[model samples]
Target: MLDKTGDAEALGFDALADLLNINRVDREKARREGWRTLADLVAVHDLENSSERRGDEWGAGSPLYQACHVALIEFIRTAPAGALPDPFAPGEIFGPKLPPTLTVV
Candidate 1:
C-alpha cells in the first residue's frame, strides 16, 4: 500500500524495482553496487548523472525519470533521518574505561 505522494510504502527489493521501473539486470547491477534499500537508491542518485550504470538512461529528460527523481527527493526530504549511534563516541559503546593497572589477587 502507498501513502500520499506514494512515498511512504514498505519497499522491498521487488517493490523498489517496480518503483524504479528497472529490469532484472539493472536491479542486479544496483544490488551489486550496494543498493539494498530505497534510501540507498536515493543516496546513489549521483549514478543517474554519472557514468556508473551500463546505460545513460536516468539522465534523459523522460517523464518517468523526472518523476522518480522528484519523488525520491521529496521522500528523502520528508522522511526522518533515523538517529544512529556514533561508534567513536566515548562511553557509549566502549563504556567507562578502567585504570590501566591490573592487581593480582
Candidate 2:
C-alpha cells in the first residue's frame, strides 16, 4: 500500500486502498486532510513501531519507515507464487503486473 501523501515516497496506501477499496471513506478523508502524506507520517524503524504485522513477508519496513507494506496475509499464504490479490482489497484481480520476487514450488 502506498502512503497517503501525494509525495512519490508516500505509502500510496490510499492508492492500494483505492485499488482494493478497503478503507475508502476513512482513507479518503485522511487523504484530504494531508495527514496521510509521507512527510506527515513518522517512519517507524522497528516492527513495534511499524504496522500491526511482522516478518519479511511484505515490505518489512522498520516498525516505521516511509513505504508501503502488504495488508493481505492470507493472499501471501495462499498465492500460487505470492502474487495473489488481497481478499479484502481487490484489484490485481487481473493478475500480477510484475513477476513474483522469488521462485517457489
lDDT of each: 0.54, 0.43
In model 1, which residue pairs have backbone atoms overlapping below 3 Å?
Answer: none
All candidates' TM-scores? 0.34, 0.22
**What is the lDDT for 76 in model 2?**
61
lDDT of 2 by residue, 1-105 (tens): 244444533536555334333344545554575654333333322222322444665455543342333334444666696465464443355544656579788
lDDT for predicted candidate 1 compared with the true structure: 0.54
Give the runs in model 1 whose Cα sits over 4 Å from its true position. 1-9, 37-61, 67-105
Off-target runs (Cα >4 Å) in candidate 2 are 1-13, 16-22, 42-62, 65-105
Assess the local accuracy of residue 29 in candidate 2 as a C-alpha lDDT between 0 and 100.
53
